[model samples]
Target: MYKILIVEDDNTIAEEVGRYLMKWGYEVEAVTDFGDVLGHFGRFLPQLVLMDIGLPFYNGYYWCGEIRKVSQVPVIFVSSASDNMNIVMAVNMGGDDFITKPFDLEVMAAKVQAILRRTYSFSAPTSLMEYKGMILNLSDMTLVCRDEKIELSKNEYRILQTLFENTGKTVTREAIMKRLWDEECFVDDNTLTVNINRLRKKLEGLGVEELIVTKKGIGYRLGEL
Candidate 1:
């Protein structure tokens, strides 16, 4: 099923849209915390976003731009402000379509299905892993945190991917080494240490400090910053 993220702050409208989408066999989530729109977007990894123009903290345009940074997912603006200026701004900010408020559920669903067919028919959905506010784009091997995009090396990407897959749990060095070995990139203890240190530095640079915690005898685990 295609997933949709609704970024509308109005509870009644959001609920109505969510219910309508769910009834049509589409997975839907309505955003509640407007301050962390991108954070929710990262975590949800929805195939398409339904955004409203007048939001609580940042407007829909800002969130749409942020989504464009890490994803090419289709975004349709749903707002009462259907003026030409707002519509132009929405498209300029990377919106795929705009739906005026008080819209018919059937019309909205049809537009959504059309966009999904056009977007996915030509490309597979990108895989994303998100923890905290950091989003890892598996297709591109890059991480986005606090609006900062960080490119990851092969080893760094593997280490982070392993940790994320087993969040809140310790992963033994032997297990990590085995995973790397399975990928045909054998690394000694020293090399692993270097990679860990480098990854830590990169994470710190993105304001994520002490995320990878080292458990002396066992291995490393993701820690709260």
Candidate 2:
């Protein structure tokens, strides 16, 4: 089933959309934190997004811009401000389609189905992930900061990729090496440390201080500043 991430703030409408989408067999997750929209977007990794313009902290346009910075996932704007200006702004901010508030559920579903098919039919979806403000592009094997870029070696990319995917939680070193060990021969502790240090320096260049935190004797984690 296709995943649908709902960035609607209103509980009634968000849950309503969730219910409707669930009935149609699309997995759904509603946004609970207004201040950290991109965080949820990274964690959810939804195939499609339904966002409302007027929100609690930053508006939908702000969140839309943030999502656009990382992935090309289809985002359909759903808002009461369906004026010509808002519609045009949504498009300018990278929204795929617009649906005014108090919409027919069936029509919304139809638009969603059409957009997903059109967007993902001919090409495989990009698998790069983002957290906070960093983007790890799996297609090109590069990590991009606001303006700078970091090229990753195979081991460095896998290690960073695994940690990013499990950000907001502790990822054991063993887990990281198990993933690395799958692709390469017996990796020594020094080898893993070298890879992690290289990845950290690349991230440091991006202005992220201590991007990957060592959790004592446990594992590694990405923390928001």
Candidate 3:
């Protein structure tokens, strides 16, 4: 299912939209903290965003601009401001579409579906995985934290990719090796250990300590930052 983030401060509208979208088989999350919209965006990694202009801390346009910095994910501005100026500003700030508030839920959902289909039909959905505050950019094989980018080698990327894919579960060493093997790159025990150590050091440089925990007689699991 496609994930969507709703950045409206009004609890009622957010809940209503979230519930309506969920009924349509979409995974949705609403932002409660206005001060850290980008943080939420990084963590949720939504395929699309529904934003309201008149937020508490910073306006939706500002948040949209910030999101554009790290991601090209589609953003749809949802606001009561139907004025021409607001709409134009929304577009200039990287909004994919605009939905004026007091909107019919059906129309809102239709707009979401249309945008999602159009945005992802010809291209792959944005491949991003987030744990704690760290984001793994799967397409470019880089890890991002606090606005900094860290490049990863092929083996390093694959290792983190496997661990990120199984965040809440332990990924066995054999399973990780199999993933590498599937790519036709054989990884023995010592090589896998070296890769894991390197990955841990990289994570450490980002102030992430013990982000990867080794389970004795088992495999590795991602720990909280």
Candidate 4:
């Protein structure tokens, strides 16, 4: 299911929109605390965000810029400020679309659907996967932790992608090899060992030790931090 975040302050509007979106089978979260919008965002990691222009603590544009610094998740502005300047600013602030206040909920829902299709239907790489405070940016093939961007080679990316996809499960060596085969890479037992060692060292450098635990002749599993 695609998760959505709503950053509007008005109680009635937030609850109403949340109910409408929930009825459509979308997992929705409406922001209540205005002080830590970004913190909420990182935890929810919503695929899309519905923002309001006139928020309590900071405006939608400010929060949008903050989100852009870390993620490219699509943001659609739903606001009462329908002026041209505000609309242009919304787009300039990394908003995907804009909807003025007192708008039809059906049209809003349709816009949400259209934006989701355009962003995800083509399998766009602008998405993030987070595990144990480690965020993998598929778009850039980089792992971000504590503001550090660790670049991953093609082989490293493939291995980590496999592990992240399975999360808590133990991924067999043969399974990882199959993923590498799909990339047309020649990976043998020794080659997989070397790549695993390198990736582990990189993770350790970021103070994330024991993230990948070997299963003793079985395979590897993603362990707790």
Candidate 5:
């Protein structure tokens, strides 16, 4: 299912839109904290965003620009200001479409579906795992955080993928070795340690410190951020 983030200040409108989208099989999150819109956006990693132009705090245009710096996810402006200037500004600021207020929920759903189909149909679905604002794009083997992208080595990517798949749980060294062997890596205990250290350094370079926690006597697991 496609995930959507709704950035509207009006509680009633946000709830109505959220409910309508949910009924149509879309996973939706309505923004409640205006101060940290980008934080929520990064955490949710939604495929599309529904933003109201007039928002509390920094307004939708500012948040949309911030999102564009990290992702090319489709953003549709849903607002009461439907004037040509506002529409133009929305598009100029990276909005994909504009929806006037008082829109029909059915029409809105159809437009959302159409946009989603057009935006994602041509591209392979990207699988993502996120923790503490860090997002791992499994399809691209890239990590994104705070507008920074980090390329991962084969072993590093595999190790992180394993830990993310088993979030908040311990993964044994034996199991990791088995997976690496299956991938034809053929790493020994020492080699695994080297890889883990390298991965930790790379994560630290991206401002994530001590992400991989060693579970002495057991194995390794990701530390909760």
Candidate 6:
């Protein structure tokens, strides 16, 4: 099930939205501390976020930008601020969609489903891969470190993709070779090594030094920030 983060101050609305979302088979958590919206966000790490405009400490747009700094998870604004200016600002602030408040729960659910499908039901990245401050765009196969964009060569990207996909656990070299070879790329074991070295250099240049580490006998992994 996809996790969802709800950033609304109204306790009634939070319970109401959380209830329906749970009924629809989504794991949801509503924000409790407006001052620490980003903190709760990192802990929840929801696939979709429902944010309200007028909030306690920092507004929804502030929290949205904070989340965007590390992730590209789909965020939809749900607020009473239905004015065109607010909607435009929402989009500019990295909100994927805007749902004006006093909305039909059914319609809200429909839009949520559509956005989830567009982001995950297809051959997308499944979702963006995030490490410390970098977001790896699996859709376009690009690594984003801060404001810098680093493009990867075919082999380099594939190698990094494999390691990050299996971030915590180590991916064996044999498996890496098989995957690369399966892509119609020839590899004689040492080929993977060459690609990894090059990818590491690129990552180090982007401040993600030693982003991919070898396990001597096992393979490689993207362990830390």
Assess the local accuracy of residue 114 in candidate 5 as a C-alpha lDDT between 0 and 100. Answer: 92
Per-candidate local distance difference test: 0.91, 0.86, 0.87, 0.87, 0.87, 0.81
Pairwise TM-score winner, candidates 2 and 6:
2
Instruction: Give one digit per residue, the lDDT tens place, for model 3 in 111-145.
Output: 99999999999998767777776778788888877
Predicted candidate 4 versus true structure: per-residue lDDT over 1-225, tens digit per residue: 889999998989999999999999999999998877876776788989999989998899998987786688889999888999999999998999999999999999999999998888877536677777667767778887654668999878888888988999999998988887765666668888998999999988887889889999889989986
How large an RMSD does model 4 have?
4.3
Listed in order, each prediction's TM-score against the native is: 0.95, 0.76, 0.76, 0.68, 0.82, 0.67
Candidate 6 residue spans exceeding 4 A from truth: 1-3, 9-12, 30-47, 54-59, 62-74, 92-97, 100-127, 130-134, 147-149, 182-190
* Cα error of candidate 4 at position 184, Å: 8.4
- Candidate achieving higher TM-score, 3 or 5: 5
Please give me the total number of clashing residue pairs in predicted model 4. 0
Off by over 4 Å in 4: 1-3, 9-11, 23-27, 31-47, 53-73, 79-89, 100-107, 110-128, 137-140, 182-188, 204-207
Error of 2 at 219 (Å): 9.8
Instruction: Give stretches of model 3 more than 4 Å off.
Output: 1-3, 19-27, 35-45, 69-71, 81-89, 102-107, 181-188, 216-218
What is candidate 1's lDDT per residue for 45-109, written digit by digit as tens? Answer: 89999999899988888888888888999999999999999999999999999999889999999
Show where candidate 2 strays beyond 4 Å: 130-135, 144-155, 162-195, 211-225
- The candidate with the higher TM-score, 2 or 5, is 5
Global Cα RMSD, each model = 1.4, 4.2, 3.4, 4.3, 2.8, 4.6
Candidate 4: TM-score?
Answer: 0.68
The predicted structure with the larger TM-score, 2 or 4, is 2
**Which consecutive 10 residues in model 1 have the weakest lDDT in total?**
179-188
Which residue pairs in candidate 1 collide? Answer: none
Candidate 6 at residue 147, lDDT?
52
